[model samples]
Structures are given as C-alpha cells and as structure tokens.
Target chain A: MLTDSERERYSRQILLFGEEGQERLKSSKVFIAGAGGLGCPAAAYLAAAGVGHLVIADCDSVDRTNLNRQILHYESDIGRPKVVSAREKLLSMNPDIRVEPLAVIISDNNASTLVSGCDLVVDALDTFTDRYALNRAAIRNRIPYIHGAVSGFDGHMATIIPGETACLECMVPEAPPRSVFPVVGTTPGLIGVLQAHEAIKQITGQGEPLTNQLVLWDGKASQFTMIRVERDPDCPACGGDSRASGRRREI
Target chain B: MRVQVKAFAGFREILGPDIALELPEGSTLTGLLEGLGRRSPGIQKALFDDQGTPLKSVIIMVNKKRQTRAEFVSRELHDGDEVAIYPPVAGG
Candidate 1:
C-alpha cells in the first residue's frame, strides 16, 4: 500500500508502470553486496525508483582514493564505513524507502543470513571469492542474482535466475586473479545503472532481464554486445543433477 | 577456411573488434589462438601464459557458446565460425 506521499513522490515513474508497479517496487527487497563503485549507482537508482527496502553490505571504509568512483561517499565520509555512508545518502535520496546498512564482510557463513528475505541479490563486489559466496547463497535460496563487474573502461553484466539461467560460477568457472584493477568512474557507473535497470524490470515484471546472456559494455568503443550463454550440466554450482538434490557436496 | 574472431576488452585493443583469419579447414581453436599470438605480442601476453598455455581466466566462445579451455584446444573450427575471446573484468 503506497502512502499518499509515496504515490506523489514516484509520480513520474508511476506513469510508466502504474500505481501497481510502483507498489511492486514498494514491496521488493533487494540485497546489494557492496558499497563500492557498482553498489553506489545500483542502490541510488533503486532507491529513487522507490524499491521498498535495500540491504547494502560492505566492510570497507570510505577512502580518499575511492572518491573517484564510489559516488555515494563524499569527502566528508572519508573514514566512515561504506555502508553507513551509502545508507545516509540513500535514505536522504528517498526517505520513502528503507535502507539497511550492514557493516560486515560477506562470507560463506554469513552470506545466506545477510540475504535472508531478499527478493533479489545484486553482486557488486570486486572480489570473485565474495561473488561466489553470494552466488551459492542465491542458488540455495532460489532467488535471482544480478552480477556486474568493471575494469579499465570495460564492464559486463548477467542476470542469474537460479535453476533457470546460467549462474555466475557456471559462466566463469575459474576465478580471475584479483588485483587493484584500473577503472574509470563511468565504466562502473554505466554498468551499475544497467544493473539497476534490470532490477527494476525484474520487480515490476516490465522488461527482459539479461537471462542466459552476458551484456558486455565497452566504454572505449561505446558499444554494448550481447553473448548467448547456457547453463553447464557439469557446473559445480547449479548443474542439472545438483538442481534436483538442491544440496551437493564437492568431493 | 575463413573465420571471424571477435575479441572484447583488452583483446579487442590488441586485435581490433573483429578480425578475419584464414586457416586450414578443421583448424582447432588453439591453432587460431597461436596464429593470433604470432601476429602481436600484446595479444600473446594477454591470451597465453609464459608456458604457452591459454590463460585459464580468458573466456573463449564459439558462435556465442562457451568453450572451456580443454574444449578450446580440441574443438575444430568450421568456416564462418565466430570466436569470441575476452578477459572478464574484476573491478567493481
């Protein structure tokens, strides 16, 4: 149920999706895994779109170096935890929505609990380790997960529908070595906004999510390319056999 | 046989967005990669390791379908096949 103020605040977008779709956004709970470059833009858009609740989890603090891309954090928030900085901005951006900031690292043990009750999970983390953890949790919970990453003016995103679509692990079976990757703000900014767009479409059932497809964004060439992907039957994450059991232990 | 190679991100920077390569019929993906590596050191370094094995992290797709590293070395290419090579970025 939208309050009178809520209906008025989302008037512009309401015209697009109607009051029902606006209410769908009001009822959705999205879990964002990072407050870095990708998370900032994703959360901002969802908040502005009137997503009912956002659970943003991050352990890092806002640093001077992060100011270039992590848009939610400003100069004044240099030493504060990223979730705190992001939560403050999101609430101020749209007081109608609820923002829950978790100042904790997302790990295998905590991933499931943190994402509890979320209608969707957004993978905006920089490390594949954390991304894998979130992937497993989403599969276990049977929730859709949106994965996005950016580096050096290039970024890619894919939407995972648990058993229905290729998962993050299924697509990238091996984790790329982690390092201090170079990136321009626009790289993640573009991809993150696309991710938010996918999320909005998902909650309101508006448009096609990037299901079974990887959308690569090249900032240099200024092009978006879609590649078809299929779930791997041997994938350790959501393979056909494992899909039946819903629990498989790695030997 | 003629095939089109579509490389993305860093690969595209070295080899351009799309390159037409001429290879003997039934040439394997490894052969195509080796041919690419011979053309430029930038692509060689990006796609292969010092030991000459395809970097495990680089993704190779044949006609929009993924080919794992093992399959990549063995899968034979046909005329007009589209091979996509890219390194998935990790930064947020």
Candidate 2:
C-alpha cells in the first residue's frame, strides 16, 4: 500500500499510471551497470520515479574529465568512486527509495551475483567486455535488459527479453571498434532517458517494450529510426544450446 | 535498379539520411557497399579498414529487416529495396 507521502510524492506520475502502477514502481528493483554518462541519467530518472531498489556497480573513481556528462558526480567528487557519488546524489533525490551502490567492476565471474534478485538490468556500461557479461547474467536470471550505447551525436537503445527477442549478441555480433570516442552530454542524456522510459513502461505494464525494434538515434540528422532485428540461431551467446535460461515464464 | 540506402550513426554524417544508389539488378549487398565507397571516400574509409576489408560491426538491413552478418556479402538487392546501413556507436 502507498503511504500518504508516496501518494503525494508520486502524484504527477500517478496521474499517468494510476496508484496501482505507482505501486509496481515502488516494488520493483533494478540493477544498473556503470555510473558513467548513460548510467547517470538512467539512474537519476529511475531513482526519482521511485524504483524501490537500485544496485549500481562501477569501479572507477570520478575524474575531472567526466563532468561533461556524468551528472551525478560533482567537482568535489573527483576522487570518489562513481558508485559512491551516484548513490549519494540518488538517495538525496529520493530518500524513499533504496540505493545499493557496489564499488566494483562487473565482469564474467560476478555478473550473475550482482544482478541476483533484481527485477531488471540496465546496460549503461561503455565497454562490450562488461556489457556482454551483464547480458549473459540477465539471460541467466530471466530478467529484462535495457541496452543503450552512444558516441558523439549517435546513440541506440533496445529492450532485450531472453527467449522472446534477440539478445545483444544477436544484434551486435562483434564488439565495435574502440577509440578515444568523442561525445556531447546530450547523446547519453537522451539515450538514457529513453532507456528509463522503456524500463518504466516494462514495469508498469503501461506500454509495449522495444522488443525486436532497435531505435537508432542520429543526432546529426535529428532522425530516430526503428529498424527490425531478430535472433540468430547460431549466435554464440543466446543461440542454440548455449542460451541462458529462457524468459521468466507465465506459469 | 535503384535502391534507397539509409545510413545511420557515423554513416549518416557521410551519406546523409538516405541516398539512392543505382545498382545492377544482381548486385550483392557487398557490391552495393563498394559502390557507395566509390561514390564517397568518407564512406570508403569509415566502412573499411586500412586493408579495405569491410568492418564486421556494420549492420545491414533490407526494408528495415536485419540481415545476418553472412548475408551482408551474399544478399542481392532488388529494385526499390530499402537497404539500411548502421555503424552502431560503442561508447556511452
């Protein structure tokens, strides 16, 4: 049941999703990987929206260079761990919610444990080396994964539900080329919000998820295009016999 | 045959939103990409490496339908087919 304060605090969104939907938000827990550009906005929105629990994991400390995009970290946070800075800000944003910030890198061995009881996972990490680990963990746990990435003025996002749609590997079969990539803050800002929007829609049952449609945002052309995607039966990750446990079934 | 090529991400900066390419009826998707390279050196450099091998990260689709990586070299284009190329962004 919503306390009087929750009812008051969420009044605006409640007008949108009603009290029952707000309860869903209050009960759901989300695992957000990374505390960088994408993760910053994603966490902020989800936190403000009253996602009951958020487990944010990142190993790096804040750098002077991160201020251009990482909104959660301030100048004083330069030497602080990303998860620590993010957690402090997020808790202040809404003390009603719980934030569990893990100060560690997410890799192959620990991905499953990190995501362990969470309702969903947010892929806001920059590197595929870590993204793939989270991907398999989401699959193994039978939870939905919101995938987003950005570079310069370009960004893309998709919702991955194991067994029901194409996994990350099926879409980005190989890791993309690496470089000292350039980005304006707005790229991750937009993509991260879209990811949070997808998450809210998923948890509240208010709308359809992205499913097989990949949203490619071209900030240069100011174009948002939805291209169809599908699973590869031979995809090494979520393919054939190698697939992790399927979706959380209805039964 | 004229095919509408839609480019996204880095490719969009080079090829704009859409470019109409005239290809021989039996041209494979690879051939069309090579044709695009011939049309613009920017695309040539972005789509290929120093040795001219196509970058595996470039995703190709037909009429908005994603084609498997192997189909990139083998799939043939038809008149009026919408071919989209997306070089996905890797950074956050």
Candidate 3:
C-alpha cells in the first residue's frame, strides 16, 4: 500500500531494485541486537530501506561518547535508553516500518526467544559474550546472522548462514577479553554499512554474501581483505550432532 | 623472516601502531608475543595476564585468519603473513 508520496520518495531505489525488491524488504523482519555505534546506522538504513519490522535491543543509555558515530541520537537523547531513542529515530524516518525497541541486554537466557521470530539477526553488539550468544541462537534456530566488529581504525564483517556456511564460533573459538578499547565512530559506521548491504543481499538474493568468509578492513592501510573461512567440524554450535543436523552429540 | 605487526586499541598506544619483527623459521604465536614483549616492554602489560600468559581477549590473526592461543605457537607463517593483534572493543 504505497501512497503517492511514499512511492515517489522511494522511486529511485525502486527503479534500481524494482517493486519486487521493495516488497521483499517490506515483508522482511530484522532483529538488531544492539543500539550503539554499529546498530544505529545499520538499523537506520534498514528502516529507511522499508524493512517491514525492526526489533532494536539494548539496555544502555546514551552518553556523550556515543555522539561521534551514533548517527541516530541527538544531544537531547544523551540520557535516554538507546533502544528507545533508536526506535523513535527509525519510526520518524519511515513510519511504514514497524519498530520494536527491547530495552534489555541480550543474553544467553533471552537470545533464543528474541531471535526466534526474526528472519535475520544483525550482530551489532560489541561484547564477545553477546556475539557468541547470538551465534548460538542463530545456529540453534537455523537462521542467518550477519556479524560485524570494530576496534579503532579496523573493522570486520561476515555473514553466517547456519548449516550452509561457517558460524562465528568456528572462526574464533573464544571471545577476546573485555577491556576499554579505542574506536573512531566512523569504523563502526563503515562496518555497519557493509552489514546492512549484506542483510539486503540476504533478503533479496541479489549478490553473493560473505558466507564462510571474513572481510577485514584496515583503515590505516586503506586495505580490504577477505579471508576464506572453513567450518570447524568440531564447532559446538553448528557442528556434529547439533540441531543443525537434528541430533545431539555428547558435549 | 621479518614480518610487520599492527596493534590496535590499547596495543596501538603502548606499542606505537606498527613494528617490524625478525623471528626464526618456526616461531609460534606465543613466540611472537614473547619477542614483542622483549622488543617493546610497554606491550607486556597490555598483552599479558597476571600469570604472565597472553590475554585471552587479545586476538591474533594471521592474514585475517584467526588463531587460537594454542595455535599461535604452532601455526607456521609465510614471508608476508600480516599478523594483526587486536584488543576487544564494543560496537553498538
């Protein structure tokens, strides 16, 4: 049900991708697991692209430090919960899309339920524990997950299509230790844009997604490299008698 | 063989962005970290744990392929494999 203004507003993108792509975007449900640096731009682009529904999950309040790269928030939003602010910004961008703001930290306990209903999960979260939890949920639910990470000038992105490609656990067995790390807001912005690009590709079946490959970007060198990832047969989540195979392996 | 090492986050501030290292033909990831510690004492605190072990969160990737702490010592390196060392940073 595109109104005259709605159709006209999206006319250029529609002309390039056609009504079918637009419809696919309109029907897809995407879950963004964080509302910070990467999540803001990624979710914003998806909403603007007409994604039918977006569930933004986060428990943190906005801080002044987030202003540099978190394009969805304003100075007035500093003390507001990121999910609340993100949803408002997204809905303001495109009211046609449904926005769900879950102001809770995504953890092992709630990841399955949170991820169960979405067509795809976007790993915009920063912590390794949450990323691994999302990886497990994606594998258990048999859904595709787009992974992104950034530290300072470097960032990386990958797409994991469970049972079809390698999961994040197979690529890195352990999470990096949590510490205060440096980041330029633009790093997440760069990676988030790529994540959104891959999500769209997954939705419309347009281009080749980075399944079983890690795309690394070194902003210092201005270099982009793709590392081929092989599934570890021993991966606990996607390997052996995991649900992906419909059996249980002794842990 | 000499390889170029790039450290990110805290490592960048401690080790000064990049360094060149000369190692034996079969240096492990542990060996490289030890070498780095010797060359730059500032990196020791950021790269090692209380028990003098490499921090688990310090990601060691050779040419973009991730290597576990155990594999760090056993994984062979070619002439131009760029080893990237990263500290954890959260992204929203």
Candidate 3 lDDT by residue in tens digits, A167-245: 8877766677665557888899999988998998899778788887878777777777676667777776677334543
The DockQ scores of all candidates, in the order shown, are: 0.73, 0.79, 0.43
Could you give candidate 2's per-residue lDDT for residues A78-153 as a string of tens digits? Answer: 9999999999999999999999989888898999889989999999999887888888888777789999999999
Candidate 3 stretches greater than 4 Å from native: A1-6, A240-251, B26-30, B45-56, B68-70
Which pairs of residues collide in candidate 1? none
Provide the fnat value for model 3, as a fraction from 0 to 1.
Answer: 0.51
Q: Name the weakest run of 10 consecutive residues (lDDT summed) in model 1 chain A.
A: A242-251
Task: Sort every candidate by lDDT, greatest first.
Answer: 1, 2, 3
Flag regions of model 1 displaced more than 4 Å.
A241-245, A249-251, B38-45, B49-53
In the predicted model 3, the residue pairs found to clash are A38-B92, A39-B92, A126-B91, A176-B57, A177-B57, B28-B73, B29-B72, B29-B73
Note the clash tally of each candidate: 0, 0, 8
Report candidate 1's interface RMSD in Å: 1.1
Summing lDDT over every window of 10 consecutive residues in candidate 3 chain A, give the lowest-scoring window: A242-251
The candidates, ranked best first by TM-score, are 1, 2, 3
The all-Cα superposition gives candidate 1 an RMSD in Å to the true structure of: 2.1
Which lDDT value does model 2 have at B57? 76
Cα error, candidate 2, residue B3 (Å): 1.8
